[model samples]
Target: MTGATVRPVAIKLDDAMKARLKRLAEARQRTPHWLMREAITDYVEREEKREAFRQDALKAWEAYRSSGLHLSAAEADAWLEQLEQGHDIDPPPCHS
Candidate 1:
């Protein structure tokens, strides 16, 4: 076992918790280990997606700031109306 990966991990749970895990594993038609691994994988994927969205939002804000562009209230309303009318307005140069 010299070159093999052998690591011991310990988890502490009460009888009720063990029973719940067993039931969950059975319901999912998986072993307890598979259930735990899948749950962890899903949680990490969700967190990554959220972080990516947050980063994209930040980039949009940064581009808006650096462009030093501001539209009047009427102009903004017209722009939105154009969008609502299905006009294919391009994104800002920086965003593009």
Candidate 2:
């Protein structure tokens, strides 16, 4: 490959696990190294996805804190019931 870097590293695994990996690799016509690389890549991608979701949750929390929307549990329920009954209820005026 052009300008691609490759490195060799040793890993330790149990005999049975290594045997299974070898069998699966042969069945898929791939080398153990290739399968291990693919597995690591998949793991990295999954972790990145989890991190992104966490970041999104944090952003949502920040927006919620800044949106000036506040309601107690009873007030929220009352508001929901009002909407269910087709009654027009206005939100409290924003102090700021």
Candidate 3:
């Protein structure tokens, strides 16, 4: 955020929610504003990663459909197991 322009945005919360936020902020020794900002940032980052993963899955599915090439589940599992056992090896070749 260095040298980046920031603008203030306002949100309205119910009384009970505001009280809860205040208590949590006090317990954490941070301002309510900081807590809200952190929450929003964490939510956005998580959602972004989830969306990227979904897009990648869609792309992979499309590629598989177009080419009809893939490794069986067992083949993929074996490759993963090898890697988990500290073996450095290529993925199993894809096939119809």
Candidate 4:
């Protein structure tokens, strides 16, 4: 009802996987095509989030290596604990 026309996608699956998909769709009371669409949407969204997390970690690692600026684990944990307790706490400053 979004007024978006549905486009058709043709996929080829091995016989075993095809049978499994049919069983899952039947159990869910959905068509195999609907199940496939839902599965792809879920997978893409999950992978995109994972990719963003990986990129952020890489950037953090590079920054640390280049500047030697970081908070010790204990300091970081203390800051996090305070925040979790709803305390308005600033993060500990990074240092070499």
Best by TM-score: 3
Regions of model 3 farther than 4 Å from truth: none
Worst 10 contiguous positions by lDDT, candidate 1: 87-96
Cα lDDT for residue 85, model 2?
95
TM-score of each: 0.59, 0.63, 0.96, 0.83
- From the highest lDDT down, the ranking of the candidates is 3, 4, 2, 1
lDDT of 1 by residue, 1-96 (tens): 379895756778799988999999999899987877777779999999999999999997797788855555666677778889999785333222
Q: Give the clash total for candidate 4.
A: 0
Off by over 4 Å in 1: 1-15, 69-96
Clashing pairs in 3: none
lDDT against the true structure, per candidate, is 0.79, 0.84, 0.98, 0.95
Whichever of 1 and 3 has more TM-score, that candidate is 3
RMSD of each predicted structure: 5.9, 7.1, 0.8, 2.1
Q: Which prediction has more favorable lDDT, 2 or 4?
A: 4
Among all candidates shown, the one with the greatest lDDT: 3
Preferred candidate (TM-score higher): 2 or 4: 4
Q: How does model 1 score by TM-score?
A: 0.59
- Tens-digit lDDT string for candidate 2 (1-96): 479897788899999999999999999999998899899889999999999999999886786689955566677787778989998988543332
Give per-residue CA lDDT, model 4, range 1-96, as digits (tens).
Answer: 389998888998999999999999999999998899989999999999999999999999999999999999999999999999999988989999
Clashes of each: 0, 0, 0, 0
Residues 19-94, candidate 3: write the lDDT tens digits: 9999999999999999999999999999999999999999999999999999998999999999999999999889
